[model samples]
Target: MEFYSLLFLLLPFAALSGWWMAVRNQRKAHSLIFSRYQKEYLAALKYLVDDQPDKAIQIFTGLVEVDKDTIELHEALGNLFRQRGEVEKAIQIHQNLITKAPLQSGLRSQAIFSLAEDYMRAGLFDRAEALYLELLESGVYKVPSLTALIDIYERERDWTNAINFCQQLERATDKSLKTVEAHYYCELAQEVLNREDPTEAQKYLEQSILCDPNCLRALILSSELSMQMRDYAQAINMMQLVLGRDPSLFPLVKSNLRQCYLMLNTKSAYQSYLQSLLEISFTSPILIEITFELESSEGTESASNYLTDHLRKNPTLAGLSRLIELNTKLVQPAQKNDFQILSELIGSLSKDQPAYKCHNCGFTASYLHWQCPSCKRWNSVTPAVTK
Candidate 1:
């Protein structure tokens, strides 16, 4: 649809270029030629307006042949082909433009860039990467070429190359890429950790924190490393720092924090910390976790009472779901069935809902992402609805 629209958009440009080419040759003889093309242009536009863009595209592509010397016509046709997913045809058109004798330097560079784009659209990363690097070395389209190289490297999971190109892009565009670079470092850290190289992993995690001090992924990895090494105190401290930075991360680190507290015989301290969070109205997964803690340490009645009060202050689907769950457990044998049915209904409502969503594009997912998968924006995916 976008491709056909682009063809329709180029109709006037193609017509003007065709007319100009005919006038440049011999006005008297080619006047009829220009008139024929003018009628064809109006017909193509009518086809487009009538929702017959394929017919419009065919007419326009043929009209460009009226002035083969018109580079803009060829370029527009190439772009149309590319947008239509006919990358081979796009590449051929741009390649022909590059091979034209006496081509201007600017036109040559444009053709190369266009060809590289065709390669990218065709998923021929190696071919596209080579052309982009060539363009970069030529100092033409430096920022675009560097950006393309960064995307290609990232897609290939070549973190070393990705980091290098990302830094170059940052310098060329004067844009801060520290947050994205931090994710690259975290990726490296995870790779090292998978290889049982905790020492090296820690070094990468440190670099990540240096890039973005409040990097939650780095903190999470650091805590994991400490836990693997039996350093419960250090793990707890790191998670506490995470919660301090973003209380929304409480659910992600809750189990780890609980394990650390249990390992150190500090459940009471953990409970006190949770109570402090509730005091400030940090009702979220925190409240849910606290309800479970109360159920275990106190009783069903105590947990029920606490949730009932919390719900009065700030109610949410999750809070309502938990309240229903608690009631199901507290009710008598005959009454339990009704409460259980209500609990099941509430759970079904929220079960398919995602815990995280992209703030930029509104893409929802079950797990956390440092970069929004849909928008490709760094630090844009965040916890949804505080749970």
Candidate 2:
């Protein structure tokens, strides 16, 4: 009986020893695999440092497996592919991540968002839109997904949908998007105007003004609508409201105001309005327009004299160019050639200069853009104050 008990204890110990040996061997194999993966990770980094992204991508794609442990690595590799403009590779990697059955909910959302970004970069906006909408429904990437959808709608010129997503985005975040929303309405108004539907366009412009009470574009559009309806007095009133709200927009409304006054047979009233603007500030374009009015009503010499006085007060290349033009008309036959040469030289210089510049990004353009094309900011592009 004693021998049998001792043997039984020995058997238990033997079983425990066998279990320990199996664990030890498994850990050793795991350590070797980890060390090998570590070496490949270092090699990938080295390739990246050498600016060889293709080789780095190859190594990283090989090193990273689609598991929860390697989720971040997979995302990193996918982003690398995207940065290198290897969008197909990025899509493939992210698509694989989403397809994995064991990926965590948060990680799967990340992969979907990344795939959507890849589609956007590839200009597959429809595909991107669908994915972003799905993410929106999931509520995992609410703000970012809404913003991406808004951008997609804007790119597609689907202003109605753009406005809808913009409103949702506003609710998702604390930031106010009223100005952007107003611009969307203005875009819709423009489309309506293009279709020769003035009444519907006016309704849209009215909504834009309701969105942003001080929307200069809406006010300008309203004035244009009035002019289209042949209500010159109402058009003048709308433009006056524009100047009252923001005098810096004088350049945009000056010609329209002049036409309204002309239709009302009120040239003197227009001159009086110009004089009032001069009292407030001396903008070169305003002064230049005044010179034209003066040349039409008064004589060329009088217009030249008036511009000379203003030029002395506020000298600008634009004002100087206008003065040269007036002098070109007034100079004597002997001095006409010299005046013409000077005018041409100034014209050449001014013609190449951009008329509008974005205060946000310093992007310059030849004509007015309510939104800066480079910065994509609304009401940021304004008349470049030439000097």
Candidate 3:
């Protein structure tokens, strides 16, 4: 049933349950309980009609104290409160249920888990962590509790604990967390790099690749570390490894790669790498980067001719933008203004287009993100190929 409709039905059902208890005076012990339910049910109806379903759920959950049969109803009410962002109310209901002496062990565990979720939603990570850890020790909800613990550690930026718990989860479930483990190591590498500890950063980066041999971020970081240490040859080799792993991500290391080649005075070698990358992945950004490199080495006319010929085979708005830019640089004084206008227009068209997108959630980004921001999945965001 629909949400509002379901809630409306619950009010009547709760009232009927109370009425039935009141009628059967054969159980005198239930008299006070029935009266309490009736009072709370009316109050809940008032809150529901006031368009405050959260408050109404709070009232209904209290009816669980009067009617044992209302345990499921109270659980549903707590979940509804949680879904509505009434986390405190949800926590109250779950906590109250779990504390009740006569509650079933299974139901109490369920309440404990639900309360942990409530804490998580409310950003009370400490509370959530404690409850999840308790659940983990109990060994009832091992996977979910461990998963929650991992998330809490990640949000806390406690990578050591996160990595440990992730490994624990992997061993328990017999599932691979190689990708996530690799990102954790990469994160550690970045932290060390920021502290100017290149040697330590290199170790973490190596661990990242060891965790997942296909970790693109590991290669990129290794390249950056090599460059920082003034090892241009190693940097270039690391970048080449990046290209071999995923040619579509060339733009990420483009500027750095160019600097490394120039530092080593290997312009010809840089051109050869570009040529090989273009052959493997026909992308506009790669083509444009190569055209600019060629323009610096071979002159405007040569670069313009090469780009124009390449565009005929593999056309893209970004390519057209570069072609116009090259032509603008080569045009005579009288026609230069017109070519500049065309170049500006093409630039505008490609400016807002993202260069990468999350394959899982369709989240678009101008730069590479090893993990998708929207879905939080590792290595799901890929380079967006523009024709």
For every candidate in turn, the CA RMSD to the true structure comes to 5.9, 11.7, 5.0
The alpha-carbon lDDT assigned to residue 148 of candidate 1 equals 89
Q: Which residue ranges in model 1 land beyond 4 Å of their true spot?
A: 1-69, 101-104
Best candidate (score: TM-score): 3
lDDT of 1 at 361: 95
Candidate 2 stretches greater than 4 Å from native: 1-65, 101-104, 348-353
lDDT string for model 2 (1-387, tens) is 332232233333332234334434554354333454756755665565566766866775565444443456567667767877889988877787788525557878899999999999999999999999988888889988998898888889899999999989888897889999999999998887777789899889988988999898898888888888899999899998888776767878888899989988999889989888777777777788888899999988999999898778778888998888888887788998998888889889878788889999999998889878898888899877633
What would the per-residue lDDT of candidate 1 be over residues 1-387, giving only the tens digit for each residue?
A: 343343445455443345345434554454343455766766765675576756765665565333334555557767767887878777877777777513446777888899999999999999999999988888899999998898898789898888899899899989989989999999999898888789999999999999888788899989989988889999999998888878888878989999999999999888888888777646568998899899999998999899899888888889999888888887788998888888889889988888999989999999888777788777898888773
Better of 1 and 3 by TM-score: 3
Each model's lDDT comes to 0.80, 0.79, 0.80
TM-score per candidate: 0.81, 0.83, 0.85
lDDT of 3 by residue, 1-387 (tens): 233343445454443334334334344454455455755766675676677876776676555563454455466667767887888888887888787625546667777898899999999999999999988888778999999999999888898889999999999899999889999999999998888799899889888889999888988999889888999999999999888867777878899999999999888888888988898878877888888889988999999899998889988898898888888877789999999888888888878888889999999998887778798888898877646
Model 3 worst lDDT window (10 residues): 15-24
Which parts of model 3 have CA positions greater than 4 angstroms off? 1-8, 11-68, 101-104
lDDT of 2: 0.79
lDDT of 3 at 177: 99
